[model samples]
Every structure is written in C-alpha cells, then in structure tokens.
Target: MSRLLLLSGGLDSTAIAAMTRPDQCLTIDYGQVAAQAEARAAKQVATLLGIHWSMITVPAREVGAGLMTGTATDPQGPPDAAPEWWPFRNQLLITLAAAWGVTRGITVVEVGTVASDGARHLDGTSLFLEAIDHVVASQEGHIRVRAPAAKLGAVELLTTSPVTEDVLAWTHSCHRANLPCGACPGCTKRRETLAAVGLLQ
Candidate 1:
C-alpha cells in the first residue's frame, strides 16, 4: 500500500521517516512560529533519505494558541496544559494530511507520536490514534493513520532507527523560533534526546 509520513522535522518524526522510508513525506505549515525552519529541515531530511517531500500551508494561526503561535501560553487552555500545546493540533494535522493523502492515493498516513507525548497531550496517545484511524478509514479513501513510533521514546526511536547524526543535524525542534532557543520545551527535549543517544556532546 502507498504510505505518506507527516514529517515535522523533529527528532521523532525524522527518525521515523529514516526508518520507514515512506513513499512520500508531507510537512505542514499551519502558521506555527517555526514553520519555516521546520519546512526547511523536513525538506533536507526527505532529500537525504531519497523520499519525495511536499509542504502545504493551511494558515491556522487564527485558531492556534500557546508557544507554537508565538504566545506565552494559552489562557483558555486547561490548567495542566503543556506550554506548547495547541488545541486539536494533532487532529487538525491528521485531517489535513489525510485530505492531501486521499487524492494522492496514499493508503496509510504515519505520524511520529512517541510514548512520552501521551503524558503531555491526549492526542498523542494510542487511543487517540486508534480513534482517528477508525474515523479516517471509515471515510472515502479508507486511509489509515498509524504511529509506528508510538510505543517508543525519542531516544529509543533514534537508537532503533537507521537515522544517523548527519540526518539528525537537520532536525529543528525549536517551537519558539527558527533557530534553537535552547530554553523552550521543544529545544530542551531535542537536546536531551540527542544526548541520550550520544549524538550531542
């Protein structure tokens, strides 16, 4: 079956792309603060892996909240919401990718949700994936949503995948800026995960 990966140029997604080598990779610019950097990184990664890559801009900044939107936090968000949490982000992204996938005859759409992601966002959980999968599959293209790395942590995923340090170098996980802020959650996680895999000094 044809497959498409929702590549975000993050540690998890990049590693997943390298491992799975899907037929095509898609990077969405939903008006996130670091959209440019993410698209650049994703394109580079896809090129390095010899996978076809495309990017789409949906311009959802009007509905976005929190750090990804260049905001300090979501005032209307849940009390325990993560700093970078975007309401219905995973769902929105999946829907957009699925919409794009169906026309391309892509039967399976892969995300890079990892084990730790569930702790911070419900959408990253297996239950969410299953539900979304069913919802998407029950429709037109019968496309399925899968998170092949859902059971693995970032470090574990990187270690298990064929992604090398050079590939990892192209990943940009900073949610606040195009360049690494070195303080945001995304940057911090990238540093820690890379260090855990001994890719960082």
Candidate 2:
C-alpha cells in the first residue's frame, strides 16, 4: 500500500521519515511563520533520504492563533492551550494530506507525533489519533492515519531512527520565523531533544 507522510521537518517527523521511508513525503504551508524554513528543511531531508517530496500551500494565517501565527494566545483558545497551539491544526493537516493522498491512490497517511506532543496539545494524543483515524476512515477515501512513533519521545524516536546527524541537522523546528528564534517553544524543544540524543553538546 502506498503511504504518505505529513512531514514537518521537525525532530519527530524527520526521525519518522528516516525510519519509515514512505512512498511520498508532504509538507504543508498553512501560513505558519516558519513555513519557508520548514519546507526547505523537509525538501533537503527528503532529498537526502531519497524520498519523493511534495509541498502544498493552503494559507490559513487568517484563522491561525498563538506563536506560529505571530499572535498571542487566542482569547477563545482552550484553557490548556500551549503557547504555539493552533486550533485544529493537526486535523487540518491530516485532512489536507488525506485529500492529497486519495487522489494518488495512497492508502495510509502518517504523521510525526511523539509521546511528548500530547502534553502540549490534545491533537497529539493517541485518543486524537484514534478519533481522527475513525473520522478519516469513515470518509470516502477510507485512508488510515498512523503515527508509528506516537508512543516514543523525541529522543527515543531519534535514537531508533536511521537518520544521521547530518540529515538530522537539516531539520527546522522554529515556529516563529525562518531563522530559529531560540526562545520559542519549538526551538527550545529541538535544542533539548538534540541534546538528549547526544547530537548536541
């Protein structure tokens, strides 16, 4: 069965790409501030991994909230919303990927969610995965959603992946800008995860 991976060029997704080497890799630019950097990193990683990569632009900055949108926490966001939380962001990405996949005869859509992701956003939880899987499976395409690394943390995922340090270095996790704003949650997580994996000193 053909598989499509929703690659974000982050630690988790990059590791997943190295491990699975899916049939196709997709990077979406949903108007996030770091879209360019993320796309660049994803393209570079895909090239290095010999995986075909494609990107689509579906601007949604108008509806985006939190750090990724260059805005403060949306007043209407959930009480437990993280600083970089985007409303239904994962759902949107999954739907878009499935839409893109179905036309290409893809049977499975994979995301790069890790265990720690659930702590920051409900969409990263297994429950969310199961729910989204059901929702998407019930649709016309019947494409299945999977997160093979969902049970592992970033460090663990990286360690288990075949990705080398050079390829891993190509990942971009900054949510605020093309160049990393080290203070942002995305950058901080990347830094910490790299260090935990002994890729950084």
Question: Which candidate comes out best when scored by lDDT?
Answer: 1
User: Model 1, stretches more than 4 Å misplaced?
Assistant: 73-76
Model 1: how far residue 87 lies from native, Å: 0.3
Model 1 TM: 0.98
Off by over 4 Å in 2: 73-76
Q: Compose the digit string of candidate 1's lDDT tens values, residues 1-201.
A: 999999999889999999998999999999999999999999999999999999999999889888999866553588888889899999999999999999989999999999999998899988999999999999999999999999998889999999988898899999999998999889999989988888788
What tens digits encode model 2's per-residue C-alpha lDDT throughout 88-149? 99999999999999999999999999999999999999999999999999998899999999
Question: All candidates' TM-scores?
Answer: 0.98, 0.97
Candidate 2: worst-modelled 10 consecutive residues by lDDT: 70-79
Worst 10 residues of 1 by lDDT: 71-80
Which candidate ranks first by TM-score, i.e. highest? Answer: 1
- lDDT for 28 in candidate 1 is 100
